[model samples]
Target: MPVVFIHGVATRAGEQYQRGVAAREELIRRLLVDRMAASDPRWAGMQVVSPYWGDLAVRHYWAQATLPPVGTLEDMGVGDDGVAAADLEVADLVKEIGNDATGLEALGAETPLRNAWSKNPHRTVEALLAPIVHSDRSVLRPQDLGITEQARPAQALGEIDGRVLAAGSLAASDEAVGAAIRDALSDDAALTVITDAIVARTEQVAPVEASTDSALESLGPGWLDTLRDRVGEVLNRAKSAPARVATLAALDRYRDGLHGHLTLFMGDVFVYLLRRGEAGSPGPIVERVREAIADAPRSRADEPLIVLTHSMGGNIFYDLVTTYEPSLKVDLWVSAGGQVGQFEEMKLFKASTVVDPPAPPMPPKVAALGGRVRTWLNIYDPADILSFLVEPVFTDPDAGVRIKDLKFKSGVSALKAHGAYYSRPTFYELLGREFGSRP
Candidate 1:
C-alpha cells in the first residue's frame, strides 16, 4: 500500500490547465515532491505518478472560446478605403443616367439604367463600382497609385475622378455600372491576405487533447470496480453505528476469505475515537491513487505496504482495506489532517445488517483478522481545522494500537487549519521513519 495522493475536485488531469494562475501548478508540484521526499527511506525506490485526467481540457475549451478578440485593428489593415471612397462617387454618375431616361425615350431608345438612382444613391454607387472595387488586381492604395506618403490626398482625388469617368461609360439600363467603376479603383489582394492570416492565427491557438480516457486505462484490470465497491461500502458503513460494526464484521468476513497479504482497515476521514461518518467515500479519489500504486513494482510479502493518506483520502483507503483487499494487509496506515473525528452520521450504522446490535461504540473490524495487521499511526497538525487538537479517535483495544495525533505549526499562516499537515517537515519525518528506507 504505497502512499497514494488523491487530489480534490477540479485538480485532476485536463483540469490542470484550468488552474489558470501559475501559482496553482507550483503549489501542486511542491506538495507532490515534498510527499515523495518525506516517504524517502520507506518508499525510497517507489515512483510517484500523477494521472492526466481531462478536467482541465474541458475547463479550458469552455473558458477560452468565449474571449474577445485581442489584436489591434491595424494588424488587419488593407488599402480598401480608397476603393470605398471611389464607389461613393459612382452613385452620382448613376443618378445622372437615371434622370436622362426620359430624354432617351424621346430619342426612341430604351432606358439605359435599370432603376431610378434617386430612390437610393448608395445602392446606385455600389452597383456601378462593385466589380472594379472587388477585383484582386486592383491597386486601391496610395502606394499602388505611385503616390508618395505626403501626396496621398492628391492621389485619392485623382483616383475618384477616374472612377467617375468609368461609371459614365455604362448604359442607363446597366444598374451595376457604378459598382464596376469602384472595383477598378481598389486592390482586394491585401485585404484577402490579411483575412487569411487572421484565420490561420485563430486555428493555431485552438486547444488540443481535450479528453483523458487513455490515462484512466493505464491502470490494471478490474481496478475501477474494486475502487468503486470499496468506496461505496465504507461510505455506506460510516453512515450508522450498527453499519460501522457491520462494516467491521464484513471486513472480518473478507479477511477470513483471503489467505495471503493480511489486511488492516483504517478509519474514515474523521480521526477521532468516534466512528462517526465525516469524510465521504474514497472511491473516485482512490481510482487515481490505485493507478499510481499499480505503476510501482510489486514487492515481497514481508515488505510493509504502507498507505499514507490525508483528509478524504484516508476514508477511501479504509474502505479499500476492509472491503476489497481483506487479506492484503497494510503495513503502515498514516493519516494526517484527518476529519474522522468529526463524523456526525452514526445513524446509518444502526440500520446495517452486518452488526449484531446496532448502537453505542462500534466494535473493531480487525478482530476477524486475528491480529495479522501491524502499526497504525494517525498524524495531525494542531492548526489543522479538520483534526481533533486535544484527543484521539480510532483506538483498537484488541490490537492494542491507539490513534495518535501529532501537532506542529503548519508554517502557512493564511488558512492555518487543514492543508499544512501534508507539507510540514515533522509529518515528513514521521512518514520517512515508517516508510522511508532505514539506513
Candidate 2:
C-alpha cells in the first residue's frame, strides 16, 4: 500500500533535526509492530511516510534571493547566553523597524503572506512577525487563575517588568527603542517569531523552585491571576511603543491574529473553500504532491493507501483534492496542524462531494467512488497557533468514510507546540490503530 505524507507551512529546519525523521520513522514502525498483536495479516508490511515540504518554501525564498530572518533554532535548553540572544533579537527587530531601508517588503516571496508592515517598514516590527509569533497562549485568561474582574491582572505591569528584566532578556541600547518588535515579543510573541531561538532560551525542564509562586500569592489569591495580570501589564507596556502601531488589549489576541496571515498565499485559498470556483490549473505545490505520490510505493487493492499530513501540507492537500480531484484511490486521510478547517467555512469536501451539512452532501457528486478517498482524521493542538479543526468540512456522516477531529496536546509550550506533533501520544495512537491490529 502506498502511504503518502504531507507537511504544513513554515516547517523550519530545526523541527526536522529535532524530530530526526529516520529515527522517528523507526519508532513509528516499532510502535505499529508492537501494537499489531502479531495477529493481523495486514500488519505484515506497512510503512509510515512523512513528506518534507519545508524545503519547498525554503527553496522558494532562496530562489527569490530574499533571505528571511532565520533564527538559529538550537536545542540548547534555556542555558548560557540564550536570554541574551533573545534580547539581541528584540534589539535587532527594533533597529529594522526604525530604519526605513530594512523595512519588511510589500510581499515576502518566501511564504508571500500579508504583513501590516508589509508596505510600511517603519510602522512596527510586530506587524510583520504577527503570524509567526506564539505569544497568544500566555496572555489573558483571567478565569484560569480565578482572578476576579475587579482585580484582573491587566494592571500587573510593574511585576512583569521586574521579572523580565531580572531574567536578563532585554538589555541596554536595544531596550531603549523597541516598538513593533517589543510589542510582539512582549508576551510569547517572541515565542512565535523566533521559535528555535526562543526554545533554546527557555528552560526545557520544569521549574525546581517556587520562586514565582509565593510572589504570585503576594500579588493576589490565585497564582494564575497573579501571573496573568503581570503579563497583561507587560503586554500593555509593549503596546505603548514610542509612536506608531496597534495598542493591543491582551497579548493572546495578537498571538491569535497570526494564524490566518500565515496562510495568505499572496492569494486566498479561503475564497475557493467558501465558494466553489471554476476548476483552474494546478500550481507548483500540486506538481510536488503529484510527484510525491507517484514516487511512493504504488498502492494496491489489498493494500491501504493512507496519507498523513501536517500544517500547510494539509492546505496543499486541500488544494490537491479540490482542484485536481486526482483519480487516485485514497484510503485514510490524516491531517494534523492543518489549516483546511479554516479554508472550508460552510462546504464539505469529502467523498468528492461538497457537503454543506444540515443539508445533504452537495450535488455534482463524483462519477464513481473508485478513486475517491475513504476516511479522513484530523488532529490538532489547542495551544498550536498554526493548526485548526478540519472535521466540519471534510467529515460527512453520509459519505460512509469516517472523519474525526482529535485534540492532541504535545506537552510543549508556545509556538514550538506546532512542531512537537511527531513526539505526541496521539501520533503513536493514530499510527498504531491504523497500521496495527484492531482491538
Candidate 3:
C-alpha cells in the first residue's frame, strides 16, 4: 500500500504570501523526500504528492470592515458598531458570487478565471473608482486589482521543535554539539559506554554567561533561587543516562527508518475546521486522502503503508479505510497524541447528515483488523496538553496496541503538536520494527 501525506490547516500550495516563502516550503518538501529516499533504497520508488487547497486569510481589515462576515447570508449595512443592512447584503452577495466561482473551480475551471469571476468586478470596480473624480472611467488599471501579498512560507511551517525541526540556520554551538552526538553514535561502541561519554561531554560544557548581566542583577535573590531550581531540574533529568541512550537510539532508528516510497499521513485536532460537531464526519476530509493515495506511484505495491495520524486524522483514516476498502490491510497505523479512543465524544455520525447512518463499526482494537491492519501503535508524549491521558474510549486493548508513552522533557512545541511524531526518532523506531528490517 502507498502512504499518503496530508498537511494541517492553513498549509497548502499556491497559497503562499511571498515567492521566497514558497521556495522554502518546496525546499522542506525536497528535504523530506530526499531524507526518506536515503533511508531506504525502496523509498526511491515512493511517490509523494502534496495537494494544494486554499486557506482562508484572516486580515485586520476584514475583521474591522463594515461588512457582514462571509459565511452568513444575513444583511447588515455599514455602521459605526457593525455593518449596516445594505453593506451586509452586499457582502452576502459577494460571498454568493465567490461560492459560485468556487463551484466552477470544483468543476475544473482554472484559478485565474475562477478568481476573476468570483470578485464580481462590477461591484468591486464601482467601490474602488467611487473615490475618483472621473464620472465615466471605462478602463480599469491593473493596479486597481487590489492584490495583496499572498500567504507566506513562514505562516505555513510555523515554528520548529525537537520533532518538526526546520531546515534553517541553527546556532553554531548547537550544530557542533549535534554533529558531535551524531559522530559518536556512528561508532559501534556499546550503547551504555556511548551514553556515558555523551553525558560526561555535556557536563564538561559549562553554562554560558547570560548576555544581559544587568537584567540578571535587577532580579531579587528569589530569582536566583528559581534559576538554581531550574538548573537542578535539568541536571536531575540528565542523570537518566539509560533512558537518554534509548532516546538517541530511537532517533537514529527513525532517521534510518524512512525507506522506499513511504507516505506520512499527518492528523490534526477538531479545531482545524472549527466546526462544532464535525470532527468525526470523515467525508469532508477523506476524499483528499484517497486522491493523494491514488496518485502515488504503484511500482511498490507490496511496500508497507506507514500511517502516522494525530487527533482527528485517526477518525479520518477509519472513514477512509471503511469506505474504500474495509478489507484492505495496512502495515501500520501509528496514532500519536491522538484522541482515537474517544469515539463517543467524536460523535462521528452526528456531525454530518451523510455520516448519520453509520456503517457497522470495526473491531475496537488495532489487532482486530487481522491481516488487514498489521499493527496499530499509539504513542503519547506526557507533555502534550491536548492528548488524552487515558487510553482511547474504544474497547479491546488487544485490537488497539498501546506502547509506553515516550516522555520528552521539552514537551510538544507549537509546530510539534499532533503532527510531530513523524519527525521524532521514537516514532522512527516503531516504524523500523516494521520497515527498517529490509536493510
Candidate 4:
C-alpha cells in the first residue's frame, strides 16, 4: 500500500515546512501504516509520499501591500489586558524570546559532567547582565554566588525570572519594568555598557574575594567578548516596539499569520480553478499530483491506494479523480479540514454539475467518484471554521458506503484549529482506528 499526502494552501518552502512534512511522514508511518501492516501482511512496507505544490499557490505582486495594518484600539475591541483582541493572540511572540533564553540556561544546568556556568557561558553572561540592563532586582542572593559547582545552578538561574518578567510585561505606563527592558534592548550601546559592568562586577565579586582566578580563567576571555554578542542577538526581539505601538505590532503579526494565510488559501483555490488546464495539458499543480499517483508502487494488484489531503488539497484531489483523471483509483480518500463540500455547494469546481433551485443530493461529478473511490472519510473539527460536512452535500444511498463525516473536536482555539489536524498525534490515532486497523 502507498499513502499520498497532499498539503494545503499558504504553505511555503522553509525549515518549518520541511519539518512539518517530515513529522507527518513519520507519524503516518507509525500510526497508520504500522497498524495496516499489523492487520494484513499485504499492507506491509507502505510508503508515505507528500508531493509539493506550494510553488503554484498564490503570489503577491505588490509584496502583500494591499493588506491592512493593525486596527485602532476601539476597532480591535480592546481586552482587559489593554491589548487588542488580535494582539493577545500573538503576545506569545514577545514572551518566547525570554522563554528560549531561560530554556537555554536551564539546558546548560542539566548538561552532565560540567558546571552549569561553564556549559553555556553566553547564557550565564546574559543572566549576569540582566539586572544592570533592565532594572535592579536581587536575582542572585550573596549566598547563591559562591564559586563552587554546587552553588552554580542557583547563580545560573538568578536573573532568568526577572528577565522574563521584564520582557513579557505589557504595562501601559512608561514607568513599567517592561518599558525599561524595551529601552535597554533597543540601545546600541547597551551591550558595551553591559560588557563593562560585567567585567567590573566579576573582578570585584568572585575571584578577588574567593581567590578563584583559575576558575574564571577556565571559561576563557574569548567567551566573555562573544557571549555579549550572542546574548544581544537572543534578546533583540524581546524589545520590538513599546506601549501602544507594541500592541499594534503584535496585532499586525496575528493578522498576517491568520488573514495572510487565508488570502493565500483563496488565491490557491482561484488559481487551481482558473488555470487547471485540460487533461492533455494539466496545470503545474494538477500535473504534480498526477505524477505522484502514477509513481505509487502498485507491484501487487491487491495493494490499496490511499490519498490523504488537507484543506485545499482535498478539493484538488476530488477534482483530479473525478474530472481530470476519472479512471484514477483511490481505495481510501481521507480529507481533513477541507472545503470540497462547500466548493461543490458553491459550484466552483470544474466537475461541479449540481444544479441550483432545490439542488440535488449528490452532484453528478461526485457520484462519478463513487466507482473510483472505495471509502471516503471526511474529518472536520467543530472549532475549525473552514471544514465542511461532505456527507450532507454529497450522498449515494444506493452505493451503501457514503462519505463518512467524522466530527472531531481538535481542542484548539478557532483561529488555530484549521491547521491543527496534521500536527496532532491524536488525529493519526483516529485515522488508525477508523481506516487502517480494519481488516
In candidate 3 the C-alpha lDDT for residue 208 amounts to 18
lDDT of each: 0.34, 0.43, 0.34, 0.55
Best by TM-score: 4
RMSD of each: 31.8, 18.9, 24.3, 17.3
- Residue runs of model 2 more than 4 Å from their true location after superposition: 12-19, 33-39, 58-281, 298-301, 346-371, 397-399, 430-439
Per-candidate TM equals 0.36, 0.45, 0.39, 0.58
> Could you arrange the candidates by lDDT from highest to lowest?
4, 2, 3, 1
TM-score (C-alpha, index-matched) for candidate 4: 0.58
Least accurate 10 contiguous residues by lDDT in model 2: 106-115
- Lowest-sum lDDT 10-residue window in model 4: 165-174
Q: How close is candidate 2 to the true structure, as a TM-score?
A: 0.45
Clashing pairs in 4: none
Per-residue accuracy of model 1 over 1-439 as CA lDDT, tens digit each: 3334433222232211222112122222232333454554443333222343223212333533444443322321123232222222232233344345433231221221223233433333233333222221121233433334432323232222222222221222243433432333222322222223322322322221222112212223322223223222322221121212221222232222122111111212222123322333333334445555566453333334656666655544554454434445555566666544443123122112244573467544322222333666666666455554213334455545434555554332223335444422233444445546221
* Candidate that would win on lDDT: 4
Of candidate 1, the 10-residue stretch with the lowest lDDT total is 260-269
**Tens-digit lDDT track for model 3 on 230-337?**
223322222231122221232222222122101112212333233322324434355566666655554464565656555555555655564444555566565656
- In model 4, which regions exceed 4 Å deviation? 71-253, 298-301, 354-356, 359-366, 397-400, 436-439
